[model samples]
Target: MSKRCLSSAMLKFAIAIMTLILLISFSFISSGAYAQEKISILIPEDPTFHDLDSYLDIPVVMVNNTDINVGGFDFLIQYDTGAVELLDVNLGPVDHCNWALIGHRPEIPGVEKIYAASGPNPLGCDFSYSTDTLFYLQFHIKPDTANECLTFPLRFYWVQCADGHVINTVGDSVYISDSVYDPYIGDFIQQDDTFPTIHGLPDSCANIPGGNKIKLVDFYNGVINVACIDEIDDIGDINLNGIPYEIADYVLFQSYYIYGPDIFNIDLQMQLGATDCNKDSTYPTVRDLIFMYRVIIGDISPYPKLGDDGNELIQPTALFVQDTLAQEVHLVFPDSLSAIHLIFEGEIVPDYSGPEGIAYNYDGIVTRLLLNPGFSGTDSAVYQGLFFTYTGDGIIDSADVSDWEMRDIASEVGVIGELICGDANSDGLVNISDAVYIANYVFIGGNPPFPLESGNVNCDGAVNISDAVWIINYVFIGGNDPCDADGDGIPDC
Candidate 1:
């Protein structure tokens, strides 16, 4: 009786142990899966239910619009909390000739002026959810030559990128022209290595009356004038300098907005010839105005948020500064500037701001800082800000600390060896290899005026023995780095 009872009890214990082990294994697997997933939120700044200061409402993520293109539209994510984000934006084909913004100036090559379309009325364009899973918007041209009949089928699409929709094109070839007038269409223009140029014209020729009120236009009549110092030769006029060259001024005209579609007429009226030998006469001249426009893709809402901590972190406005002017200095954040500092170096100047001081003396406006070339031996200018150079993790609670701190800036990047010497070839840094450059200019170089001898640098002005000395001082002894024509300290060579 004892042997049977012992065997049964042993079997029961084994079964119970196995059941406990299975439960523990399942719990471990579930926990590991959760850890592998990333932490992603739709909005970095939760707008849950709060009193917004402005009319612009924060958008909620419609998870359905994840990857699907609504109609023929492209989407992008403007901002993402982490998990939800825009995938990509399709700008358009590569071949179209792009144009810049009208009246708006591009601070850099590829970037155009972004208009801050703010007011009390409803914005010209508003975004909304389309399908349950797709956030979509179609921008239609009001009507113009390409879409004058409103039948050009010119459309730009905004599709969900990550948490937001990116402005893009669905299909190709909706409109064709040297430069399209529709902002929506232009938004999809491909960004190329080469940037578009503004129609170079005098300001007088910019204000002509024609075309869509929003489109850019050119003004001025076409009658090029010339000066005649001597008798009017067959070629027409000669200046007092005795040089017979065309003496004419050029102008550019453009319109701001082209709402729908209308005739954008090009009137080229040329005036007869006139002469002012002494250079004191003013006559009507043929002027041309070229207008440029750039499409800015973003939420164009400008309503303010009352007691909004988010608003305080961002600058009231946006700017497209060039790298040349953006390289210098540490970006200032709202924290105190006395604690930490960022070190930056490059052909560009350093921009710095914080508790130490503001970059510009004009106003407390902490725009890009231009380092004093008078202090450094670089060619590029400095750009400073009272914010982080780029988006990143910060030490302070950026939302609460509104004033820029002095020590918190960090130089995240630096352009090394940007100094240029008498190399004459304009390459940064000087070495024995530059000797060939010297020989070419001295012996074979031909010109109306030989390369200025004083520029030889070595002081003999002969471009030979003297030039070498100038190079040595600039590179080693720190001679007045002549290249710094701007005196911001960077050698402007």
Candidate 2:
């Protein structure tokens, strides 16, 4: 308990307390440094030229100064209503932020509100980015603006971090100048204290031969203007109607040529343009009339032969064949066509029981099927597989295949002929023998029938006991004749 001992103990305690305080201070500084991240809204400093009545795209960019992930943001953009008119607000590509909501208040004419958030809700956005465009403001310069410069100021109303912490952010401003180039005068002038004016086409374009009826081609930078004369070349359509050349149109063309424009109540000049079937780029003549007659008789098509709406006419040429082994009638097309609709007139099988419902494949130079719904793939030229079903009686014959029609992609109807169905055995007749063959194949795994349609006695697609019973009923009980209902030389299935 001496004085020297008391002094030494007090000094040691003081030193120990100071060491602990310094360690705590160091820990606090380290934690603060790790949390020091910021977010901001950046506006470009460059001034854009404001062209009257022209669109100006102003980009609002978001800057994440920290490496921390951002969850969501709410922004407010204020513009000068008198200087520019807001047309549209579009969202930009903010990675991982898939949901966005935008609102414009017309009552507060110049203000736009935007709220965007990232996905996988609850956990919110799981992405980190340095900079990205938040949205675009499409504005049109007002025709009556007097200000030389328009300013758009951005304000971050609310910003949230991935951890659900509200963040404070800084925003910037964008400037657009009203001083623009006057194309007529070829000079830049400041728009001040006066309404803006839009430049019109040059005086030379005003005196074009076709007046305002000419089409403007290659129009760029408001300088080069080429006027093209519009001409209609619908061969055989002498009446100027929006249909294919027909007999009525032929008569009109002939009468107009023999007599004069006064011979008909229709516009003779327009009729001449339509009747120029040869497309020789000249007026209609006797040769054009002859061409129209040929088109009617299917000898030839009108020059530049096209159906309505400039689409090429589809004359579907189908080859109907019987798959003896499968016992299915396939209607094959030479070219690829889509949206095909076909009608079979006689008895034929409709459904197939195989794994391949109807066993169809696009086998040609391009053979790719698009599995996606609503997807029109590049291979649209060759399409196949149209199965026939019994319409009248279950009896399929040659007439069924011969008396069928198909509509091509262009909706043009075409007739098919010389094709036969219901000859699965290829024996030329559908009867009890055909039914027995089908049953043997289905039950005992006998030889498959050729031109498969013949084996489908019941026209139910598969050769089975049901088809055998159908044949027995038809042969003995007079139920129905197989492939001979109408008795026309062809099967109508």
Candidate 3:
């Protein structure tokens, strides 16, 4: 063979091998790119129960379906602002890379824009990716949009790889709709078959002995579930105040007896339920009033039976221990309760304007002090005085306190106790003087606070600088109220 022919043959063989190698590499790269190059907005299934003015959180997800490391991407999300207001955006785990909010624009009357980008430290750099949430968009459903389906559309401008390659990315929209019971999985199931069997029959189910029968025969193959109805019953809740029987309950019962149910602007059925203090399966009778009075005077326990739903009623207890030296009374609950309503019956009057004094709204007969905002698991609070010094000798006991009531989230009532807090100077008020007194007792050679526990404003067990600082902050800068570790409403030592 000639030299030229041999060289040409050798060149052709080398070219063929190189081409095969390139084809193999290209196939692997293509498959990896396809696998990792998609982004989506994930909307969770509608909650079992949804109401107007509720907030919903929707997530933006990136499905890194390729072998290439992700450097960055730009995203534009659009949603109906009228149906739901975009309250906030929260970063997700995938937001380790630097992210910037480009701009947010109201595109139309109902629609709005959220534009954001995530990339390398500077820009156009690569970061590895798997499946991860990129961010969350928090939205508040508008009242008018209740029962309506809302859609969130996502658009990805570009997804760049670590090697500076722009990959084609797929994006999806999320749909949020009101919760609805579906009779069938799809459009094909017949309504007759989908209807649940009521007592083994359909139309005549209500006439059956139990009204509806639920059977759990297949223990191995089936699941049995019980769900409590969300309705809260404040039965024996006199005054219809969403609490159990109290002094107000007696007054409300009397008003109902004298003037009839129409005298109060309350639901008659709810009132009847609440006013049934005796819970003898009857409503608005002289017997119920007498039972309520007895309960209020501590003659009989309120609601000594289980609720109509067969659940044990939550009964909270409240008590107060007086700090005689500080002249402050601290409200305490034996168990967790949300709110408390106290009535000073005799000559007892709580000083309502001092530092430790809690301001309250008065309804002539009773002075109301709301311990915490709404219903709280918090069971303690401190008030300045149990009785006004001028009105009486300032000595208060359970007798001077006409009524003490506590309530839980379900409006279940319990008993309450009283005590004192934050009055370090042993004065009748918690004020700048108390902070000064704590500071002097801690820093200088001064007499220690009357109740040493009150000097520990932070309730850290020691009268120290932090306690003085805490007291100063409470008196001047409006810091948190003194700590009550035991929930006894007293600043603990």
Candidate 4:
């Protein structure tokens, strides 16, 4: 055989080997995929879907058909105007869609409202009867893509209530079971305060004996904190006085069912309203209350806290909290603007006074308004222009990275600039207060603020004799000082 022929034969043999290897790899990949569990979408059993008017007061059921038991579930009910309401998710009585029930009367707690700052009064400021006719019902649940992989074939259902009221439902239960997936159930930190009252409904499953029945579970979606309310009437005897306190506003709450997994990190917002009962004021404005919660099913495993984000568990004696999580709007105007009433907007949680709907403000002027967290695009244009006016420099700077965090840390460190604790000698800062605080720690059985002293006057991390000398120089020796951390009060040094 010639050298060229031999070389050609070798090349063909090598090609044959490579082809065999490729075929083997492809077979393994396909087999592995096929072996994975499949998921499917589930929906309410028929008849209920055909007509919801017959089952207004009844519960909706969702069926899950994943191969592995799912811990819990969640879904969203988007309104025609693009408003999305989250349904109860802890898989029980119904899937996660029964959380939209508006009661004919108030029975829950903390959701009732009498007078809103807005213009038109819907239920009359009398706080009379609570009804469910004001709203249209709908919802949808998407998979938590981060925590779990959704495989094909995952299914769930929604059983409508039997109250005679009809709600428009849309969207299909998307199946996601075949692939390896996890649920993105968020985190929950043990808080000092009780969970905020969440207004909603309970899951309604069939009365099956054993084969996977829906469990009526209780869930905290969020809070509807009514920061303030105002009422007004013109040229007439106001019979109800200020606000009447509706039953629906006070009693509406959220309920759910849990079975396979736990639901956590729920949130809610209280809608504020300014309706002119007399219809004498300008067009009404809307407002909102921010709320949130977390669910823990049968058992709670270890989870991360907000501060302990990275590997370390930064245990804190006390955690800081804000009035709202999402951004909000604050209004500030000259004398003429004080009378313009402001309102908060959002969906009403279920409560007793009424269907815990939004609160509308009746009448009033606008003074200084501060929207917690921040504001959104829909907020009043006037409010968006008002910035937090900071008196004196260094106290706050928009460009500072941790300026807000530093203020909070200072408060936690006992230098809150309030009582004697912050005002050492009551003079305020580095002056006599600084000297007094240092003396007391050194000789008067007092403990110096440890980590906090790092931000203390004179740039010394520890309260020592040198700090005392510097305090004296700044207070009496005509030395320039930079210790006015906050320029509100007189410098103690």
Task: Give the Cα lDDT of each candidate.
Answer: 0.24, 0.40, 0.40, 0.23
For model 4, the local distance difference test gives 0.23
TM-score of 4: 0.16
For candidate 3, the TM-score is 0.24
Error of 1 at 32 (Å): 29
The per-prediction CA RMSD against the true structure, in angstroms, equals 30.4, 29.9, 26.1, 27.8
Tens digits of per-residue lDDT, candidate 1, 373-455, equal: 11122322223242424321111111111111111112222121232335343333354324334443343331111123324
Model 1: how far is 233 from its true place, Å? 92
lDDT of 2: 0.40
lDDT, residue 23, candidate 1: 38
Model 4 Cα lDDT, one tens digit per residue, 57-80: 112222221232232233222111
Q: Is candidate 3 or candidate 4 better by TM-score?
A: 3
TM-score of each: 0.15, 0.24, 0.24, 0.16
